[model samples]
Target: MNSNYHISSFCKIKNNEVSLNGSVIYNNENNNFSAFIKAAYKSLETNYAKFFKMDALSKLAFLAADVLLKNEHLNPEEENNIAIVFSNKASSIDTDRKHQQSIQNKEDYYPSPAVFVYTLPNICIGEISIKYKLFSENSFFIFDAFNAQHLLDNTNSLLSTDKTKKVLCGWVELDGDDYEAFLYLVTNKGSIIHNKQNIVKLYNT
Candidate 1:
């Protein structure tokens, strides 16, 4: 693993608002979750002229990728090492709920394949990769909660292999009535000035 690798920037969205913009650490000033969701839906409407009832995990991943892709410093086309490693606790439970609901009602037993496809947790990765045109290693994991050690371990393993030059990794978790997301753009080239303390300060800010 590249010991030199550090997180450059990250963004998170949840509860209908952006919890963090593209920053090395958390920033409460940008943590209006409801507003973030509104902005994301607006952006999607403007770009795609369509929208779906996306769950918390999907919303968080899409918003994070949007911020990452727009970073002027990162060159996606030139960055062949770019990859995505995301995790969630619920693992598309919202989609499963809808799918089940569709089958529960005999009058509405028609299942939309489009909706069914998103029932998998990794579908969010596919959505982000398609948006970014990233044909690189992608993975998804499920944990009971935000397991920092697991994140670090998995990311280090990926970086160690040198198969990916850069990794976009983080946790996107949602439980009943609660949601949180944390993402990082890890690269060996850039420097990270923020540590845990810095993260706390930024979150308080």
Candidate 2:
């Protein structure tokens, strides 16, 4: 896919949350995974019920996507040309840990199907699509680190084929004692350059 769409803007939430051309959404001192999850959820919406219902990975994706979309003022339905391409390192290991723990505990040796369903990395894409009603091509890739060249090449191929007019691509990784999500909204209409250098510069800035 040779996509011409440029990333108009991006947002990231990590140990110390950061945003491109926007304010930091949240900065929590608790340093607990649950605390980070709660702060991230609050960054997305005021409804706590909805927040608690989402799995850990889903919550992370939602918060990152929500912040990016809000900053870009993007409506997936209106555009009707948006897609999501997410990559991660841990690949839902956190969920897997919990599931394994459930079965390991003889007293509570029952694995909840709900929790097991989120073991796949793509679940985050599903959650984001459902939340934004984006019925476009979505994919989840597992990598060792932030592979900017892979992202650029893959996105370019996807866009070149006219399969998707816009793309939301990023690295959303989570694991024990670590969590980070960086997302950018790329569109065919913008001045932003689409290359490894620009991608690195964007993230660095």
Candidate 3:
């Protein structure tokens, strides 16, 4: 049993507020998602230019993952075993809406391949894997609501298998200007237990 799994760090970003490990890092009354994400990226001092082309949902996931990995010592061997497990209610619907609008009119029909690529929610996982050099197992799930049980079960299952040493799991939901992300890194080291109840408390708290 992977009973030793623990949550080392957590990051929650949404409602114009960003928190790391239960402490608020950035907060504002601003309601703009893209602008705030851009600000967060700049604040992290990351030089990834591809961030500018990502859709809003991917941007949110990318920033949240970046915040979790910031200034942390990552073992090169362990990096490949770091898996991602993400969930959302919208599941790329925000970008789907934009992609639909791109061809709504024949007079101005111009669908973008760049924008089209983000229609699948799992693409963000790929983006994160590429950015952080993670090549381990990963999956993205979409549910009607936040299901901490499913997330925890799958996370533990991955860890139980010897294929992965750590799992980054959470909800990264978005629609228009409304968005929320609560991401946590679970491993064998940390005080917090990686259970369903704890995940719910961390997300709601």
Candidate 4:
């Protein structure tokens, strides 16, 4: 059993609040999702130019992953040792709605290539990978709900096979104005045990 793996850090973003390892790092109750997320981005002090162009789902995922990896020092030799495993219930429906609206009216149909690009949820993974230079195996699963067992299974398989040294796995769901992001980094050293039960409990917390 790959029971030695642990959760080094976790991040939760919901209700216009962002918390890292159980402590609130950013929160804004007065603004909507767009303004709130942008505020959070500014708080991180990251200057990724492309961030502004990403759809809401990508922006949310990017911000959540950024909170975890911001302070991480990547070794050139081990830069490819990190993997990302993310799941979401909505599955890019937020962006799909935008793309659908752009062409739904036949009389004035105008499909946008920019909006079409983000119709798939996995693009957020690409955004994170590009920013952090993580080239390990990455996957995005869509389930009716958050499936921690599946995440555990895949993460354990990757680690046990020595495919990567760490796994960034979590549930990032966004449906219109309702959204939640729970991301955690799993590695050999941490304060929390990496298991199905603990994964579920941490997500709830």
How far is 77's C-alpha from truth in model 3 (Å)? 10
Candidate 2 residue pairs in backbone clash:
1-156, 1-157, 1-158, 1-160, 2-156, 2-157, 2-160, 3-160, 5-187, 5-188
Candidate of highest TM-score: 4
TM-score, one value per model:
0.75, 0.87, 0.93, 0.94
Model 2 misplaced stretches (Cα beyond 4 Å): 1-4, 43-49, 74-79, 106-109
All-Cα superposition RMSD per candidate? 4.6, 2.6, 1.9, 1.7
Q: How do these models rank on lDDT, best leading?
A: 4, 3, 2, 1
Candidate 2 overall lDDT versus native = 0.76
Q: Judged by lDDT against the true structure, how good is candidate 3?
A: 0.86
Question: Which candidate number would show the highest lDDT if scored against the true structure?
Answer: 4
- State the lDDT of candidate 3 residue by residue for 77-112, as single tens digits: 455568999999889999998889877844676787
**Residue lDDT tens for model 2, 30-59:** 677777768656655635366576777777
lDDT of 4 by residue, 1-205 (tens): 5779999999999998999999999888844788888888898776789999999999999999988887466653445568999998889999999898889855676789899999999999999898888999999999999999999999999999999999999999998878899999999998898999999999988
**Which is the better candidate, 1 or 4, if ranked by lDDT?**
4
Against the true structure, candidate 4 has what lDDT?
A: 0.90
lDDT per model vs. reference: 0.64, 0.76, 0.86, 0.90
Model 1 poorest ten-residue lDDT run: 22-31
Q: How far off is residue 119 in model 1, in Å?
A: 0.8
Give the higher-TM-score candidate: 3 or 4. Answer: 4
